[model samples]
Target: MKRRVLIGLFGFNLLRQSSAHHQQHCLSFLPNPIKHCTSIRQSLPQGAMPNNVDARTMFSHIIKASKLRIISILMDNPCAEVIVVPVLSDNYAYILVDPDSKESLCVDPAEPRIVLEAAAERNVRLSAAFCTHKHHDHSGGNMELQRLLPGVEVYGSCYESVPGVTKGLSDGEIVKFGNLEIRCVKAACHTVGHMLYYVTNPGNPELQPILFTGDTVFIAGCGRFFEGSADMMVDIMRMLRGYRKDTLVYCGHEYTLRNLEFAKTVDPSDSVMSKLSWTERVLSMNMPTVPSTLEEVCTFVSSPTNSTLRFLISFQEFQYNPFMRAGDLKDAVNATSEVEAMAMLRSMKNRF
Candidate 1:
């Protein structure tokens, strides 16, 4: 009876491949890793699509993220069991939980009413608020929620006031709550001290690790450069790649469709084309596309094969791909030594 919704904003691309074209669309539905999430994983044979190794592998992994194991909590199924509440403009607030314990955490709350209503409906306690950064859209409801629910621990970056932030943490600090363990990562580019929260339940390691990557990282996209430099963001992304491949990524906004459109201009090809098509389908359904895995994200954004995609990809692009641990990619991003990534980001921002 728990209701949930997932939202995603993919990279932007203007080229619309004919919908009628019979190119094998990788359409395996990953189960909703939220309360209303319902998905089944299907694996298509490899090497099926020419010019799209990254898309094929990435989508395949995404379907895997949707596959549920044994449901030990609220519902009798294994899938994403949470709620997506829309907040300021394009942002979304999420309620993540461990069904069996009835313990839950709120991610980037923008409005208290939506969270309070969801909590009341389930008769569950809101023990923690995991914030991605200090932006208002992501943390506007923090203070309100704290006022409404006494004792809910608010977690965020050490650099800014995250509304209800009860704990000021640094990178690599791990906190335990209920059956979950969250690793705090310093994702400083979006905000000088922005942080991404990665959560995992020790009791169910099979469940993918979930990352609340606020404005720093997005589905098929990344946040606009603000406080930190491009190299800083790149280093942070490399650190994220250290986690398991199946980690689930829950970001702050719904800009995936538009992000993908922009990516096409940078790298116009079949890989971007197919992925954009898939993004359109998700948007069409009006479903949230968060809770994506690290592996899938890396495949789409970090793989060297999509060099053209790199031009359109901002230095913040590193925020989305944690698998670039080698640091070699950072060099590529910094190749144009004379020109600062932040300066380039500023130029792009002016255009917008």
Candidate 2:
């Protein structure tokens, strides 16, 4: 009698598993079907399905029934929205809104009123403010924004003296706004406590990552070394270069035309520069020339060798940058190292 009882228990367990499998298959065929059948299987209560039905035929029928529903579900969610708000003179502030949640975060809001107005116009509730550094032009509106939207979190570098900072962030720290993830990168050069924000959509291949480079980097030029050394700037540049090639860069200012003009002085014969210069001139009259990819910037400043004006369309500006230029300048001032070159360039730019 004991042997018979043990066999009976074993058989019951097999029957339960078979029933669960059959239920999953039946659910697939049902009208108004659930999304992700795997999830449905895991959510099933014990003993939900009987073991007598044929699961294979049910699964096939479910697939045929749900084809249209699957397509409709896949088409529902769109990419998140990023709105650019121009602030003082050339400074820019960005408002990022999650498509699903409608929750938003502001980046480097120099003017609180403008940011607030923009958010209101878009019907998004501003939830946080992310400051890149302590510069008044970048973090000036932090306090005002805090006052306007009470309880809205303010995030800034732990090392920086950002105004109205509620949370101090460090290098490699990750912050989330809905489904979007933002990675904080330490980029101390233009200022000692500067940080860059890299935003990405995990598990979503359709959306590309974007970089919010405050004042550390510009379109064709880099920020002047305000409180750091040339070596520090080099380190930051190298770090930025390691990001994914397709990453979109949204910088702090509308200095692309000016930076590209300066780049022309460095490599006058570059054909690509000539084309881009003209393009920027036309675009500036109507729209902003931002959201440039890392790949485009890298190509624009890549080092070239033994080429004519056409072949030299893309040339690295590092050696041409008074700060990154090695050896002697026209005045016989020698910069023996990369750091020295950057120092010399910074001093010259100050005078220029």
Q: List the residue pairs that clash in candidate 2.
A: 301-316, 302-316, 323-341
Look at candidate 2 and tell me the lDDT of residue 74. Answer: 11
* Model 2 TM-score relative to the real fold: 0.66
TM-scores of all predicted structures: 0.66, 0.66
lDDT of 2 by residue, 106-131 (tens): 99988777777666655677889999
* Segments in model 2 whose C-alpha atoms lie over 4 Å from true places: 1-79, 269-272, 275-279, 296-336
Candidate 2, run of 10 with poorest lDDT: 5-14
- C-alpha positional error of residue 234 in candidate 1 after TM-score superposition, expressed in Å: 1.4
lDDT of each: 0.55, 0.59
lDDT of 1 by residue, 1-352 (tens): 2322232211111111123643211121223333221221122223222343221122212212122211110111222345555555678777776645668788887776666665555456788888877878877778888888888788888877666788888988998877678788887877887888777767656555667788877765667677866677556655765777666667788877776675564444455566567567546644455555555333232223333322221112323321222132224335343234434433443364
